[model samples]
Target: MRNLFFLCAFLLLAVACKSPEARRPVQRSSGSFIKESAERNKKLYKKEEAIINKIIAQNSDKDFESNPNGFWYFYNVKDTLSTVMPKYGDVVTFTYDVKNLEGTTIVSEKEIGLQQYQVDQSNQELISGIREGLKVMKEGETVTFLFPSYKAFGYYGIEEKLGANVPIQSTITLRSIESSEEN
Candidate 1:
């Protein structure tokens, strides 16, 4: 009886291991999550662009140099010592003070101390604005950045150590970015 049972189980296993053509057809949806996410991001980006434009119109006197990545920057202290900007994978040390366009201080170098940032794709600590802004800054330069919400904080505002949401749809200014390169 045991031999007969083993023979039956062997037969079942043989039937199960069929050719690929015998397998059930895979039904892949025509719609994709990536396409949906991209569409949502585009709407958010457009909203941020409008908000930044209004802020720029309000402060017409300040020369805000805009970038393709949605951040506007201007040098407060243009030092010629380091004319070359740091590239990806370069280690840059800097002190930064970030504030909202309404002039509310979000965080400062005094509170967080100087930071050593590696210019790369995976560093979430640096916002899209700061990361892109760094590409234009040279060592010993103090640059002020005015970036849209999409570049600075996205839909969700930054959460501080004190657990306060800094709020969104607000343009942010990097009050000071004093960067120095390490040999």
Candidate 2:
């Protein structure tokens, strides 16, 4: 009688510990979450593009005129530095001072040092504006090009610390310090 009582007690305890459902938390379907995020990103991209277009329209009347060969112009120089710009495979070194048209120093190379960038057809290393700017510069020329937010950061601002709605109408200036020597 005692043994039977002990076995029954053990079985009762085991049954009590068993869970009616699995031990893991129920997983949500990722497809729905991904779709929602993609829609949100598309909306944000459109908003950013609209702001950039507005800035481009405003700056269109500035000194530089857009040319088939160059990105954007600051002044109407027939022999713009871009006339001798580098090709995509060329490597170049440069110093730059990026500022708004209002002369707010957004970035300065004197404070940071010289920067080197390679011309990449694959859009791997440089922004489209910078690439366009470099295409029209000589080895020892200093040129300034303005980049609307669309050309600058677009819908996604600087990936690091710059938050959203940071105004895409800001300007940037770049100077070509040297052209790399070909081996």
Candidate 3:
């Protein structure tokens, strides 16, 4: 009986020490959550687009052009002669003001003050809409951009001032563009 017990103990230990097997999850995730989240975002963007379209319709006088980046803009002051636009490594100085769709000012030009940003480089934190808009602007040009919530603030918005996922309007004045080649 003692020998049998010893043998049983050794067998148990050997079995326990055998290479561990990966335990399969009882219920595998079907990725429904991700799909649902994506669907929700699609609906939200569609609704926001409709609202932006309505605003554009109301302001027929202003030429609001749709951007491929899912924002809209119209030139407040277009620079026709200057074909120069900021490219990668170029530093651009500009001032911008943020407003809601209802034309309420969230941030004034004075509050934002002067901004110096390096094009296509992560030197400064800027909204995606503004970043894309700047690439298309000529020096001394002032463009009013209408950005969707995703382009403006997305999930995280300006603290205390702008709520999450809020669409906004920003008018950027491209004061100067220092060419990288010049540097």
Which candidate gets the maximum lDDT versus the true structure? 3
Error of 3 at 105 (Å): 0.6
- Candidate 1, residues 1-183, lDDT tens digits: the string is 999999999999999997667666588776788899889777766776676677778878777788876677667777667567766667677777677766567776587666677777345587777777777877777777777666666556656521222222222222333333542
Model 3, 140: alpha-carbon shift in Å? 0.2
Where in model 3 is the C-alpha error above 4 Å? Answer: 1-13, 25-27
Q: What is the lDDT of residue 157 in candidate 3?
A: 86
- lDDT, residue 121, model 3: 81
Q: Please, what is the whole-model Cα lDDT of each candidate in the order they appear? A: 0.65, 0.56, 0.93
- Global lDDT for candidate 3? 0.93
Question: What lDDT does candidate 3 reach at residue 44?
Answer: 87
Cα displacement (Å) at residue 171, model 2:
6.2
lDDT (tens digit, per residue) of candidate 3 on 92-179: 9999999998989999999999999999886588999999999989999999999999999988989999999889999999999999
Per-model clash counts, in order, read: 0, 5, 0
Candidate 2's C-alpha lDDT?
0.56
**Model 1 collision count:** 0
lDDT of 2 by residue, 30-147 (tens): 5988899789767765665465455557866655545463235453233443545666556677666555544466556576466567776344445566666666666655555656
Worst ten in a row by lDDT for model 3: 118-127
